[model samples]
Target: MRDRIVRRVILPVAVAAALSAVAGCSLSGGTGSHKGPAAPSGSAAGRADPQAAAALRGVEQATVRAGSARIESATAMGGMLSLRTDGALGWSGDPVGTLRITYTGGQLAATMRALSSTSLEARLLPDAYYAKVGDTFARRLQGRHWIRYGYGDLAALPGGSGAYLTDQLRDTAPLQPVRLLRACGDVRRVGEETVRGRRTTHYAGTITPAALGGADAAGLRERLEQAGVTRESVDIWVDDRGLLVKKVERGELISGRMSATAYYRDYGVKVSAGRPPAADTADFRELLSTRGS
Candidate 1:
């Protein structure tokens, strides 16, 4: 149970939380008062789909301008894990936030219970993230209640792809959808749709390997390849004011199929996250080293 939770639930959720922080960065369009032209419906003429590009560019600019948001998300990885998270995050330039994550169902949830609970409080900072674990797990760390995972340390983990995790946490979360759009071969407006009761413009696209290449690729292609995602589908919903309200990403990983859906709100809301008390926090790398010895 411990192994399963660590592999399937804990690690995946940590990644998801980091990515979700990025989502906050792209969804808040500065003070929530800025507005852009509405997206055109259906596919626009041209190889580059100028209409779609313009609309998404507006979303990108708005999100960067706003800088913070409240988010709710759900993620699933095949049948191994299913989880939900709710939190507020800031992405003005550096990512900062906190989340209450719950293991809702699946094998991972069962395993989490062995540690005394199926929920965790995660705090994200510019350089690392901290997870509050149950007392059962804390007992293994000389009674420490938190585990700190630094972005740099994640790169040195066992998996050769661990660096990808570090890169994503450090750089790619908020603009992942925008990157997908830039790398997509068939970006188009899917028409207007209702999301969480608000009217929004729906955009969809397919990300192919060929699309992943460019002078400014930013290593996204290599990261996707490492995860076994040859091709993936992406969907985004932008609210009437030109802010991203929701997004969905789906793809196959070497481990299994994975999907995540996230909703964003309260753009420009103030958010802050602080490091756990040093005395009560254990560095994840040290924990691993100690266990190995």
Candidate 2:
């Protein structure tokens, strides 16, 4: 009985399939991607308005100074899979957080329900994502409920999705959109708007990583290209205090349309995510190796 259970988890097909569903692809349409101005090409790339450039620079600074915050985010792809995450994340240094990630609607959600769960407790450390299995499979996992996917191992995976996932896990944070805005440099200030009852200045831009040039240009282009993202539309809301209150980034992928919306609050919050016990955890790479053998 133990051997059978071990075999089932060695490959962890269900978990791997769920990863593929979102793996760097928010690829979606309805969430306002088409409504915005498309990215300019050729000579029009980085000529952002002076005021807009300055504002984004301030935004980048403000958000980075805030250090950490509570985040609620939802992402969907091609109308097929949607998921949400709620947690506090610390980005003062290496990103870290503990999030309850729920697969809300999708064929994958159905499979999770069949397994008696649609949510997973994920600990996001600087180097890896540790997903805690549900009770239904904990016994079968032999009291080992955690599965570790190291970012380096993920980057080594053959597909572009893995590299994309690596980029997302490693470089992603509330500060990402702001950085992208500064990098894209063709930002437009869309005046003021109310967000979650707070007044905010709306800003929008299109990002084509390859068109950008600077210290950040090469890394952005390489990471994005490896993820199969040709271009993206991003928008952000910054409050009077210059903190990012919300952001929307949408783009297309070979599989479908992708969209993600995130809200930030409770800035300066103290965040902690201690590692799982090694005895109660399994490294996904090790599991793959064992299965292959």
Candidate 3:
């Protein structure tokens, strides 16, 4: 059973299909490539508007010096897991690039620029991202490889074909904090509480975008069906300073908990737009290519 589960997860059926559509290649075949959209319009409008309920989202995005948060969750399977992300705000470790996320109007745009570091190791893997460490004197580098497999597609909204992944992005928007106000949803403060010894403000809400309707909606439904999973509500916990501390959510293929802790560790006050120096894909390409080769 363990082996079967591993295999199933290794080649998430939904991901495989999505890749095939975009790359025209299967995970078993390394002949796939991803082409971005021809330049999206209406983004300006999207960024200008803020959802009515998430006014406090701005406070959460303020410059966080240093902090940490914990996440304790009960899965649909009755399993419990706890996780943490240290240095969430904007703490520049020993040396290297800087990861920043800022809100424009009401939209959240992030930029991972080259920091005072060298020997940086940034890669866009099959489903996630990783950056290497370096020194200050090194020239800053940046670029966009592709949509993070683990994160939602920023180019599109959470609906219509592949809504599963898009929805996942919006669900965890609080983790970035910038989207608290930009994301279209109803959020209510669930009062204050202490999580993992740190005092945090808890918020509960549901996101149902009317944009997720019409014939186009069928595409999203189909993608979910391919994954053998359904969409679920997302719950979040934020610190007293309004920063996101934790998020609990379930998606079609994967469900887990993500948390941030440590002073401005992985978190950033604001972000810039434009591509980075170069894209990273060595790790994921290696993982997929080795097997295929």
CA RMSD for every model? Answer: 8.0, 5.5, 15.6
* Model 2 residue 253 distance off true place after TM-score fit, in angstroms: 1.2
What TM-score does each of the candidates earn?
A: 0.82, 0.79, 0.36
Residue-by-residue lDDT tens digits, candidate 2, 182-217: 677677787888999999998877787666655677
Q: How many pairs of residues in model 3 come into backbone collision? A: 39
What lDDT does each candidate get? 0.66, 0.66, 0.30
Candidate 1 error regions (>4 Å): 1-48, 213-218
Residues 100-143 of candidate 1: C-alpha lDDT, one tens digit per residue: 88877666577777777578888879889888888887786789
Model 1: lDDT equals: 0.66
What is candidate 3's TM-score against the reference? 0.36
Q: Give one digit per residue, the lDDT tens place, for model 3 in 1-293.
A: 42233122322222222222211110111111222221211122122222324545454444323322221122121111111111111112211122222111100001111222211222223234343323321221123222223333322322333344333322222232223223423455556677667787655443232323333345434433433323223345566555655554423223321111222213443322222334532232333223311
lDDT for 170 in candidate 1 is 57
| Model 3 poorest 10 in a row by lDDT | 102-111
By TM-score, the better pick of 1 and 2 is 1
Q: Is candidate 1 or candidate 3 better by lDDT?
A: 1
